[model samples]
Target: MTNPIVNLFAFLSLLLFVHCDGSDPAIPEDHRFYETMMVDGRARTYLLNLPPDYYKTNEDLPLVIGLHGTGGNAGQFERDYGLTEKANSAGFIVVYPEGIRSNGVLGVRTWNAGRCCDFAMKNNIDDVLFIRTLIDKLVSTFRVDAKRVYVTGMSNGGMMAYRLACEMPEKIAAIAAVSSTMVVASPCHPSRPVPVLHMHSVLDAKVPYNGGKGIGGYYFPPVDSVLGAWSAANGCAVRDEIRNDDDRFKLTEWLNCTDDVMIQYYLTRDGGHAWPGGQRSGNWGDTPSTVINATDLLWEFFKQFEAQ
Candidate 1:
């Protein structure tokens, strides 16, 4: 007779494979589908949100891709950032792309945003290529305005935004990074000048304002250095203006760049390692600031530019 214990173990292994087959479940009519793609032999997933008017009109609309931070998933980012509601009101499409998970769980995801971070970086995953492919897929599948594609992200995701701006400037019109700095060592050379906005908090302990090694041995360049590099690359002038300065928040703009590409920075007095005016997504260490709504401000900034 055959060994009963061995047969039971084999049956359980088959069950586990079925459970982890990477298929999406049925999504609600109001909610977007959790889509998956095969990139470099790895399965990648992302959530897409279309505006209420998407089906109502044939007009081409702008697309914004939002990247999640390390140890954060696309679902959590979409829920916490509240961009879908904003997209409905503003008439744009929004996408939240999930990063590779180190532990194959929702809470341990990380992007290969260059030299920093965990599994994605160690494995040398080409995240920039993946994002470019995602953009192409969305543009062809939806009524995406080719001249109005933009990107924004939080922490590690923010760093990925900068990487996209550097490598895919022709595709991305602008980028907004919150609580993140450029971690790449070499100078960034974009095909064209791209508008950029950075938001940070003075009290952020994780990615220090001045920059250094952060948690998990991730070395972050100083925020100023990050902005300075972009400014120089974009040929921005010395013209700098401070807007919306108060006890809570200060906005600085570097004007007169090539193609009118403005580089802006927002410094919040508080809100350590958090998206300004966003909900704290449990134990993520994001202390939202009350000074400014990042989604509103970034959308306004993004609307000012189109791909040249």
Candidate 2:
């Protein structure tokens, strides 16, 4: 008999997969599926946005893995962040990974970003391993620059980004956490220096810049504590001078790191736990104009590091 799994998966695939039609299509038409695999026995979908010239050339391109926040999916990020558009224009490939969810609940997905995740938090999911497998698949399938692989996430996804940097520092180039802080059982001490950019809103009641009273009713290490741990691991000097932006976001930048790995913090005064400069997704109503696009600012930060 024909495999029922294959048939069901094919139907699901048809519903999820769509071709990119634009002045610059990211993935090649011939390689539309990109690839697929299951994690935790659940159907986790991911979208691979290829650079326009991927099919035309063999030059390796940077790969960016964008993780979505809680109650989010890959498609939402693909449209809201416009990562596909950015990847097509910037000559990089973007991978949008869907988070695994549990029974009966629809659309409420979250990452195993250590502390949060009503389901994943209890299951002890191996998200780091899942990411490693995803990376291995992409590297084998396309001309991905091994040294230029980066991770960025929003909210819970941002926490996952920090986890990756802590556990897989050698594998990633750098990381940017937007409206998310680090969540660790103990503390994350990276073996090697990984550049990090943390952008958060001072007024964020939900994952407050000062820390306690997390969104999911959990406690996490404060922002200052998280930054201090990374600084210690990365061997950054304690900055005496603090810089304040027009938006009331204070930054204490640690300059001149080994191998040019530096740490920059973007603190916005009025913007709440929202992506520093991302579109207000109705969650944080009426964000200010001074709030810069987190994606653009993150791209600027990520460009500073090269695979060493």
Candidate 3:
């Protein structure tokens, strides 16, 4: 033999390299990866975070689509929203979808949530289709549980979440909106009753709690109006029912709805337009509430329902 020991050493070295390089051969071999798809003949980009042991098993994990607020990009939202860490711990996959950029800025972007946004709204960008197609693409590319797809966002992104629920209820199992309200002028209608969870702070300057012009100069309807619309669309017996209460926050819900769907809202006395228990966006960003971990609550809510 030329060199049997050397050959064994080389083989071991090759295995080490393969282990370090993640030789899974999956479309996304890394835990945190990127993928691009075409929607409306336009290139759309998204960042994906898979659970740490994702490639270790053949599990079909649930997917959570996180949308950024106005003037935000996917990376920034991913960093500040605290979803990736939650995904790792909860054994779910989370993706942050980038919105179309505004003309004046490089990274600043907005979503076409129906109305009251900047570039995307003015151009009437097809964000709804983008998200719907994104879900389909994820299902095609990854081992995602199609029936357990959930969506969540903040501010403008949250409004976009509302829009998606209104337009494509069948594709989504449930939705949770934070610091957002339905700004779509069209009447609410869905193919089926979709479960909803909403969280807000009474003191939020942007997306004001009682309805009025926000710090972004966008006019909003009262929270009651938003809940009323959702309740009626889901065929709830009542608009709001007090479920729980605390000094820092109050829990309201709509339980008696068609198909047993439920709607829950959390109004916190503290905090502003920020993700509850997430890192504050910036030095000047609103302080998130400390009472509840939204990531945990949303996952708890999301795990209960599936698309039927």
In model 1, the Cα lDDT at residue 61 comes to: 98
Stretches of candidate 1 exceeding 4 Å from the true structure: 1-26, 103-107
Tens-digit per-residue lDDT, 91-110, candidate 2 = 88889876665443243556
Worst 10 residues of 3 by lDDT: 16-25
Query: How far in Å is the alpha carbon of 138 misplaced in model 1?
Result: 0.7
Give per-residue lDDT, candidate 3, residue 153. 86
Write the residue-wise lDDT of candidate 1 on 77-140 in tens digits.
7767788889989999998887776654422567888886666787788898889899999999
Candidate with the larger lDDT of 2 and 3: 3
Residue pairs with backbone overlap in model 2 = 26-50, 249-267, 277-292
Q: Given candidate 3, what's the lDDT at residue 303? A: 92
lDDT value, candidate 3, whole model: 0.80
**TM-score of every model versus the real structure:** 0.88, 0.84, 0.88
lDDT of each: 0.81, 0.72, 0.80
Q: Residue by residue across 219-280, what tens digits does model 3's lDDT show? A: 87787788878888889996688877879899999988888889999999888888888878
